[model samples]
Target chain A: AQRVTQPEKLLSVFKGAPVELKCNYSYSGSPELFWYVQYSRQRLQLLLRHISRESIKGFTADLNKGETSFHLKKPFAQEEDSAMYYCALSLTGGGNKLTFGTGTQLKVEL
Target chain B: DVKVTQSSRYLVKRTGEKVFLECVQDMDHENMFWYRQDPGLGLRLIYFSYDVKMKEKGDIPEGYSVSREKKERFSLILESASTNQTSMYLCASSSPIRPARGGYTFGSGTRLTVV
Candidate 1:
């Protein structure tokens, strides 16, 4: 079975501190990984995808196939960065169904 | 700009009552999905449609049904609403025409409550 796992349920960090949200997956074939963020009173939106390899909002995630991980990281955490982050994996076959992790709540305090 | 809209921002329905949650997208995307977002569980797919009148069962579709009469509209129906079904329902759309970009545009979402 395909699954995505986010180790932390809540991650608190002071402003300007580095942040890392760990994500791991289990799949036999290649998978497409994504990071989605949902802020307070806001809709869930796509933050970034491993395919593009582009950084969004100062955050970057690298897909390590050998490690079966796609960890999201930021050099300096900002107050505005606080939100519920979900790590998702998309199966390349059959419409690319997405299986999301439980999610990690990042609280960046001043 | 691509936009997906759900019919209601919040809905309260009694258990055993039938419920309908409508979603429309103006992007004319070929794929539309209905998912329920829950705390600590993330989003779970309930149903999806690839084209008009075509539907597919997702990971969790036991008590749910869907309709896609038109290209831009998709509807989720709960034959008998249960307290367990109360959740944040989200609608999303993506252009299957472009397989390179795995991006999905989501709606604001509807908070459904069962009494």
Candidate 2:
């Protein structure tokens, strides 16, 4: 079974401060990891995927196979960055079903 | 751009009433999914379909059912709505033909409240 765990429910940070949302997964095979973001009054959207290796909105996540972690990080938090972030995992040949974490509510205070 | 659209933005229903949540996608993708979002639980997959008339039970399929009679449409059905079922419902679509690197396209979501 594939499971994703996001330890933090709420993360508060001052503007310009670095932000990191932790995520860990349990899967026997190589996994595809993604970070989905839901901004205020907006639909949930894909922020970044591990396979893309491209940063969107200054957010990046590196998949660590050894630790089975894919933590989302940003160099500096902005007020506009406040939103709900969910970490998801998908296993190859697993029908592309996404197993999502509990999610982290990020609040960037100005 | 791919667009996945949920039929409703909000819905209020009484307990025990039959409820239906509809989703449509214009990208002609082969896959469609239904998920429910709760405050701390994130998005829980309720059901998904890979082809017309083909459905798969997701992680939390209890108290819910789905139909995919058409290639572009999927509908989630709640035989008896319950308070515990009140939450934001999201729909998404993706194509396996594309590189797995391309993530899903999601709908705006429908906020359902069962009283």
Candidate 3:
């Protein structure tokens, strides 16, 4: 079975501080990893995917096959960057069904 | 832009009542999904359809069922409403061919409350 784990439920950081939302997955085969974000009163949107390897809003996540982790990281936390983040995994070519982690709530303090 | 729309922004239903959550995608994508979102649990897939009239059970599908009579629309049905089923339900759609750009397009979500 495919599973994603996000250890932190809430992560509070002061503005301009570095932020890292941990994400790990359990899958035997090659899997696709994605980071999704939901801002206050907004719809859930895709932040980035491992396949793309492109940074979005200063957030980047590298898929580590050996460690089975895809941690989302940002150089500096911004007030507006506070939101709920989720790590998701999908089979590389298997119909695109996703299994998501519990999620992490990031609070950027002023 | 591709748009996935949920029919309701909020709904309240009594226990044992049947509940229907509708989702429609304007894009010609081939896949549609229904997920329930809770505070700490994030989003759990309830059901998904790859093609019209084809449905598949997701991780948490015991209390839920789904219908997909059309390619662009999928409906999630709660057999019997229960307080445990109260959550924010999201609808999403995506293309199966483009794995690189197959990120789901999601709707605003429907907040369901079972009393």
Candidate 4:
């Protein structure tokens, strides 16, 4: 079974500090990876996709095939960056069906 | 902008009552999904449909059923609402067109409370 694991339940960082949220996946074949974010009282939206390799809101993630990790990174955190982050995986050409991880709550403190 | 709209923003129901959650997408996406979001569990997929009247069981599909009568509408049904079923329900839609750029569009979500 394909599974996505987000190691941290909560990550607290001061504003302007670097942020890294860990994510690892177990899949036999090649997979498409994604990062999704949900702000307070807002809908879940796509942050970045490995296939696209485009950064959103200063957040970027690189898919590590060897380590099977796709950790989200931000050079400097902002107060508004605090939200619940999810790591998701989908089989290549699987028709957009995704398997999401447990998620990590990122709290950016001022 | 393309949109996925869920019927209710919030709902309260008694235990053992049947519950229906409706989802509609205006983007004409080919796939629609139903997920339940809990504090620690994140978003667990309950069901998904790739085409009209075609439903697929997701990772956690027990106690939940789905209906996709039309291409734009997908309905999630809880056979009998239970306290454990109380959570924020999310609806999402996606398509093969521009899959990389447009990953998925999600609804605002429905917060369901079963007491």
Residue A102 CA displacement from its true place in model 1, Å: 1.0
Cα deviation of A76 in candidate 2 (Å)? 1.5
Q: What would the per-residue lDDT of candidate 4 be over residues B1-115, giving only the tens digit for each residue?
A: 6389899999999999999999999988888999989988888989999899999999889999999999999999999999999899999998866654338889999999999
**DockQ of model 4, rounded to 2 decimals:** 0.71
lDDT of 4 at B38: 92
Best by DockQ: 3
lDDT of 2 by residue, A51-91 (tens): 88999999999999999999999999999999999999988
Position B84, candidate 2: lDDT = 96
* The 10-residue segment with the lowest total lDDT in model 3 chain A: A90-99
Clashing pairs for predicted structure model 3, backbone only: none
Residue B29 displacement (Å), model 3: 1.0
lDDT of 3 at A46: 92
Q: What is the lDDT of residue B48 in candidate 2?
A: 91
Off by over 4 Å in 2: B100-102
TM-score of each: 0.97, 0.96, 0.97, 0.96
lDDT string for model 3 (B1-115, tens) is 6399899999999999999999999988898999999988889999998999999999899999999999988999999999999999999998887644449889999999999
Q: Candidate 1, after superposition: displacement of residue A107 in Å?
A: 0.2
- In model 4, the Cα lDDT at residue B66 comes to 96
How well does candidate 1 match the true structure in TM-score terms?
A: 0.97
